[model samples]
Target: MAQMIVRNIEDSVKTGLKARASLHGWSMEEEVRHILREAVNQPPPARTKLGSRISGRFAGAGLLEPLPELHAQTIEPMVLGE
Candidate 1:
């Protein structure tokens, strides 16, 4: 088993942890270990791009053509206070 040391925790956070541990009938140390174990055991969420997600959502809606990408448009800066 690996030992870990965490420092500089806020007083309020420590108090909260103690309360949570008491609620679950565990020591503060046991509560922290349980929390850490659960955190590490869960799988990470998928990272999908916004464009791909939109395409997937509307895939069956009969939009077969891909949109052309716009290129090199000149922008006129706004003139403030005539």
Candidate 2:
């Protein structure tokens, strides 16, 4: 495996990276490698409608609760005047 060196990173950026690495249970170097891999390795997101994407995400999650039936007798039809 090849190695890469990064220099001149700001102190705040380094601190943030360290904190993020700790949160994810990784060393700073491992976090950097993970970030770089994610940046370069992801396949392009599918070119699909937003609805399709959303549906695909929750496809097998679970059944939603059924809505209660509304009182049809109390509803009035809309009256349009010309």
Candidate 2, residues 1-82, lDDT tens digits: the string is: 9998889999999999999999999899999999999989999876999978887898778858744778755877898995
TM-score of 1: 0.71
TM, every model: 0.71, 0.51
**C-alpha lDDT (0 to 100) for residue 36 of candidate 2:** 94
Q: Identify the runs in model 1 with alpha carbons over 4 angstroms from their true place.
A: 52-68
TM-score between model 2 and native: 0.51
Judged by TM-score, which candidate is best? 1
47-67 per-residue lDDT for model 1 (tens digits): 899999998999989978987
Count the clashes in each prediction: 0, 0
Worst 10 residues of 2 by lDDT: 63-72
Residue 32 lDDT (model 2): 96
